[model samples]
Target: MQRLQAFKYELMPNGEQQRNMRRFAGACRFVFNKALALQKDRQAQGEKKLSYAAICKALVEWKQQAQTLWLNETPSQALQQSLKDLDRAYSNFFAKRAAFPRFKKKGQRNSFRYPQGCKIDQANSRLFLPKLGWLRYRNSREVLGEIKQITVSHHAGKWFVSIQTEREVAQPVPQGGIVGIDMGIARFATLSDGSFIAPANSFKRHQAGLRKAQQALSRKTKFSNNWKKAKARVQRLHARISNVRKDFLHQATTAISQNHAIVCIEDLKVRNMSKSAAGSAEQPGRNVRAKAGLNKAILDQSWFEFRRQLSYKLAWQGGHLIAVPPRNTSRTCPCCDHVSADNRRTQARFECVACGLDENADVVGAINVLRAGHARLACEVNAEVMASAAGTHRGDLAA
Candidate 1:
C-alpha cells in the first residue's frame, strides 16, 4: 500500500544561511498574519474575504514595492507556498476537517511547509530549489520513499529539513500473538498479556530547566533583543521535551506493534480525562501557583499522538488496531463484566466486586479492552454471515 511519510534531517547552515532562513520564515509569517487580519476585517465590514489568489497578488505587489522586505532571504516559491497553506488551512477549517485558523503569535511558531519540485532526491540527501542552490544534508535515517514535498523549519535554535514522501509499504500478516493495550496517565500503557510500559515523565525530569528558561523569558521586555534570546531558550527547552516524548512513543509503539497481530486500545477522550478540579485555597493539585505547570505535564503525555501512530503503523504492518469504546474499561471486570467506580480504590489496585478478581487497574483496563475487541470481532463475523444469507435469499426470490 502507498503511504505518505516524512524524513527529517538537521541542517548544517552557516550564520548567513541561518539568518536568511529566519527572514524567509518571518516573511511567511507576516504574510499569513496580514492576510488573516485583512480577511477578518473584511468579514466585519460585510465584504468578501480575500481569496489566496488575491493574497498571492498582494504578495507580488509587496515584493515589488520594496526589495528591502525580501532582499536578504526570499525564496522564489516560498511565499507562493505559504499562501497555498493559508488557503488549505481555511479550506480544511470550513470543511470541518480542522479547527478554525488561529492567529500565529510571534515566538510561538516553529514550522513552515511548502511545495517542492521534482529535482529533490532523498537517496542523495540533496535538494535543488528555485533560487537556493543544490543543498546537501546530513541525514540521520535513510529516506524511505519517493520525495513528495520538503519543509524546512527551525526548532531548538537549530534548522532542520523534512522531506514528505510517498512509498508502497508491504503489509504482511505477522506470526506473533494478539495483545490489547490500555493507556493512562498513571501507568502510560498496560498490555493484555500482562506487560506494562511505565510512564517516564520526561517533562518532570526537565521541568527545573524549563521553569528557569520560562522565567528568564518572562522577565525580559517584550520585543527586546534580550527577550528574543530568552524566548529561544524557552523554545529549545520545549523542543527537548517534545523530542523526548516522541522518542518514548516511537519505542513503545514499535515494541507493541512488533509483538502483536492484533492490538486493542481504549478510545479515550484524553482531553476530558486530563482535567483536574480546584481544591481549597490552601492546597491545589500540586501548588496553587503551579496549576498551569501540572496541567502542562498531563497534556505532554501525548496519549492521542501515541494512538494515532499506533493506528497507522499497525495498519501498515497488516496488524489490527481495535479502538474499543471508552466505557468503564478501567472499572469493568474482564472476568465477569462488573463495572463500578468503587472497584478502583487506588491508582494501582483493582478489585472486582462481581468476580473477586484482583489486578492492577491498568491491567484490568487492558483486559477489558481486549474483551471488547474480541466481542466486536465476533459481532462483525455474525453480521457478515447474516448479510450473506440475506443476499442469497434475495437472489433466490429474483430467480
Candidate 2:
C-alpha cells in the first residue's frame, strides 16, 4: 500500500536567506492577488474565466513588464504554483467546498511551494530549495519516503518547511478491539469501554496572558516598532496555543486509532453546531452570551480535527472508522432500546424509564453509537450477500 505523509521542521535561515524567503513569499502572494483581481474583473465584464494555462501565460508577460520586473528575482515555478493554487481555490468555490478566493494580506500565513528542486540532507540537517540555497533545520525526525513537494512558510516570526512524501508500505492486518467514542467539550472523548480522554483546553489555559498581550498591542501606536513587537508576541502566543491543541489531538487520535480495529463516532456537523445565535435587532435572540460561550467551548474541543486525524491514521493502520447519526444517542438505552428526551435525567446521567437501566450519559451515548455502527455494518453485509445471490439467480435463468 502507498501512503502520503508530511514532515514539518523549523528552518534556521541566515539573514540573506530569510530576506530571499520573505521576497519569494511576497511574490507568490502578489501573483495570487493579481490573478484573483483579473478573474473578478473578467467576470464583471462577462468574459470567460482565465484557466490555469492562461494565467501561467499571463504570468510570463507579468514578469517581463517594466513595473513588475522585480518578480523575475523570485523562482519562476513558485509563481506558477501560486497561480495553480488560485485556480484550485476558484474551483473549490465553484464546487461549494469553500468560499471564494480572497486577497492575501501581508505577514499573514506567508508561504510558497516548490513542487520540484527540493533536496533534503539528513546528515547535515539541511534543505535545498529552488532559489534559496542550503538552509539548516532542526531535524527532529527522519524524513521517510520520496519527497514529492516542499512548502516553506513563515509564522510567528519563524520560518518552517513542510515536506510531503509518498512511500509504499505493507498494510497491517486488522487487529485490536472495536470501540465507540462520544466527543464533548467537558471531556475530549468518552469511549464505549468507559475510559475517557481529558480535554486539553489549551486556549483557555493561556487566555489571561493572551488577553494581556492583546491589550498591550491595542495601546501601542499603529505601524510603530512597539506595535510590531507587541503583534509578534500575540502571534507567538496564538501559535503556542495552536501547537498545544494540535499535539493533544494528534496524541489522542493516534492512541485511539492504534487500539481500535473498528472505531465508531457521531457524525457531528461542527460548523452548524458552532454557529452564532445572535439574532437581528427586529427579533432579538435569547441566551446570546450563553450561546457565544457554548460556541467557544465547541470550537476549543477541536472535535473535527480529532476525527480528521483518526480517519487517516485508521486508514494507515488498516482499521475502519464509522460515523453514526448523533440523534438520541444519549437518550437511547443500550440495554432496552428505549429512547426518550426524559431518559436523559441530566447532562451527566441517563436513566431509561422503560427499562430502569441507569448509566453515565456519555457512556450511554457511546454504547448507542456502537450499536448503531454494528447495525449499519450488518445491513451492508446483508445487502452485499443479497446482491451476489441475485446475480447468481439471473445467471441461472439465462442458462
Candidate 3:
C-alpha cells in the first residue's frame, strides 16, 4: 500500500529570501483575487465562467501589461497554482462542498506552492525553490518517502514549509475491537466502551488573553509600529490556540484509530450546526446570543476535522469508519428498543420508558450508534447472501 504524508519545518530564510517570499505570496494573492473577480463579473453578466486555460492566458496578458508586469518577478508556476486554487474553490462551491469563492485578502494565510520546481537537501537541512536559493531550516525530524510538492506559508511572524511525500509500505493488519463514538459539547467524545475524551477548549482557554491582546491592538494607531507589534501578538495568540486544538485532535484520533478496527460516528453537518442565528433585519431571531455561544463551542470542537483525521488514519491502519444517520441516536434507548424525546429529559441523563433502563445520555447514544452500525452491517450481509443466491458477486459487504 502507498501512503502520503506531509512533513513541516520552520524555514530560516535570509532577508532577501524573506522579501522575495513576501512578494511572491502577495503576487499569488493578487492573481487569486483577480481570477475570482473575473468569475464574479462573468456570473453577473450571465456569461460562462473562465476556464483554467483562459485564466492562464489572462495571467500572461497581465504579466505583459505595464502596470502589473511585476507579477513576472514571481515564479510562473506559483502564479498558475494560484489560479488552480481559485478553480478548485469554484468547483467546490458548485459541488456544494463549500461556500462560494471569495477574494483573497492580503496577509491572511499568505502562502504559495511549487508543483515541481522544489529541491530538498535534508542532509544539510536546506530547501531550494525556484527563484529562491538554498535556505536553511530547523530540521525537527527526518522526512521520509518521495517528495511530491512543497508549500510555503507565513504565520505568527514565522515562515514554514510543508513537504508532501508518498511512499510504499506493507498492508497493516487492523488491531483491537470495534467502537462507536458520540461527539458533543459537554464531552468531546463518548465511546461505546464507556470511556470518553475531554474537549480541548483551546480557544475558550485563551479567550481572556486574546481579548486583552485585541483590546491592546485596538488602542494602537492603525498601521503604526506599535499597532503592528500588537497585531503580531494577537496573531501569535491565535496561532497558539489553533496549534493546541490541532495537537489535541491529532492525539485523540491517533489513539482511537490505532486501537479500533472499526469506528462508528454520526454524520454530523457541522456547518449547519454552527450557522449563525442572526436573522436579517425584518425577521428577528430568538436567543441569538445563546445560539452564537453554542456555535462557538461547536466550532471549538472541530468535529469535522476530527472525522476527517479518523477517516484517513483508519484506512491506513487497516480499519473501517462507518457514518450512520444521526437521527434519534441520543434519544433512542439502548435497551428494550425504546425511542422517545422524553427518554432524554436532561443533557446528561437518559431513561428508557419501556424497560426503565437508565444511564448517561452520551453513553446511551454511543451504545445505540454501535447497535445501528451492527444493524447496517447485518443488512449488507443479508444483501450479499441474497445476491449470491441469485448468482451475483457482492463482495466486502462491510467495506
Candidate 4:
C-alpha cells in the first residue's frame, strides 16, 4: 500500500539563515497578495485577469531587474507554488469545501512551507534548498525509509523542517481485540471495555498565561518591535497548548490502535456542533462570554484531530477504523435497541426506559458504535463474497 508519512525536525539555523528564511517567506506572501490584488483589479475593469504562470513571470521579473536587492537572495520554485496553493485554496472555497480566502494578516501568520524543490538527508542531519545551502537540523526521531521531500516551516518563533518519505508497510500484528469509542467534551473518550480517557483540557490549563500574553500584545504598538515580541510570546503559549493536545492525541491513538484490531467511532459533525449561537438575557448560550469559553473548551477536545490520527495509524497497523452515522447512537440502548432522547437523564447517566438497563452514557454510546461496526462488517463480507461468486460464474460461462 502507498502511504504518505511526514518526519518533523527542529532546525538549528544561524542568524543569517533565519533572516533569509524570513525574507523568502515574506517575498512569497508579497507575490501572492499582489497577484490576488492585481487579478481583482483586472476583473473589476472587465479585463482578462492574470494567470498563475503570468504572475510567476512577474515575480521573476521583479527578482531579476526591479529588485536586485533579493537578486543574490535567489527565489525558489516552491515560492511560485505558494501562489498556486493560494489559488487552489480559493478554488476549494468556491467549491464549498472551505470558507472564502481570507487575506493573511502579518502578525497572525504562523509559518510558510517550502512545498517544492527541497531536499533532506537525515544521515547527515542537513537540508538543502534553492536559496539556502545545507543547514544543520536538530533531528530527534529517526527518518523512516526513503526521503521524498523536505518542507521548512516555523512555529512559536522557532524554525522546523518536515521530511516526507515512503516506506514498506509493516506486517500486521494480530490483536484479536475490538473496541468501540465514544468521544465527548466531558470525558475525552469512553471505550467498549468500560475504560475511559479523561479530558486533559490543555487550553484551560494554559488559558491564564495565554490571555495575559494576548493582553500584553494588545498593549504593544502595532508593527513595533515590542508588539512583535509580545506576539511571539502569545504564539509560544498557543504552541504549548497545541503541543499538549497533539501529545495526548498521539498517545491515546497509539494505545487504541495497538490494543484493538477493529476500532469503531461516531462520524461526528464537529464543525456544525461547535458552531455557537448568540446568547442574550433570554438566549444565554449565544452570549459572547458563554460562547467564547464553552466553544473554545469543546474545540480544544480536538475530536476531529483524534479521529484523523486514528485513521492513518490504524491503516498503517492493518487495523480497521470504522465510523458510523451518528444517528441516535447515544439515545439507543445497545442491549434492546430502544431509542429515546429521554433515556439520558444526565450527561453521565444512561437509563434505558424499555430495557431498564442503567449504564454510563459514554459506555452506551460505545456499545452502539460496536453494534454499528459489526453490522457494517457483515455487510462488507457478504458483498465481497457475492462479487467473488459473480466473477467465478462469469468465468465458467466464458469457458
Taken over the whole model, the C-alpha lDDT of each candidate is 0.79, 0.94, 0.93, 0.82
Estimate the overall C-alpha local distance difference test score of candidate 4. Answer: 0.82
Better of 3 and 4 by TM-score: 3
Per-model TM values vs. the true structure: 0.86, 0.98, 0.93, 0.89
What would the per-residue lDDT of candidate 4 be over residues 310-354, giving only the tens digit for each residue? 998888788998899989989998888889998998999999999
Write the number of the candidate with greater TM-score, choosing between 1 and 4.
4
**Residue range 1-399, candidate 3, lDDT tens digits:** 999999999999999999999999999999999888988899999999999999999999999999999998999999999999999988998899999988888889999999997888889999889999898999999999999989999999999999999999899999998899999999999999999999999999999999999999999999999999999999999999999999999999999999999999999999899998899899988899999999999999999999999999999999999999999999887777777889989999998887898899999999888988888878888999897866643345433
Model 2, position 344, has a per-residue lDDT of: 91
Per-candidate total of colliding backbone pairs: 0, 0, 0, 5
Off by over 4 Å in 2: 393-399
Model 1 TM: 0.86
lDDT of 1 by residue, 158-178 (tens): 778888889987757765777
Query: Global CA lDDT of candidate 2, please?
Result: 0.94
After superposition on all CA atoms, how large is the RMSD of candidate 2? 1.2
Candidate 4 has what TM-score?
0.89
Residue clash pairs of candidate 4: 277-286, 278-286, 279-286, 279-287, 280-283
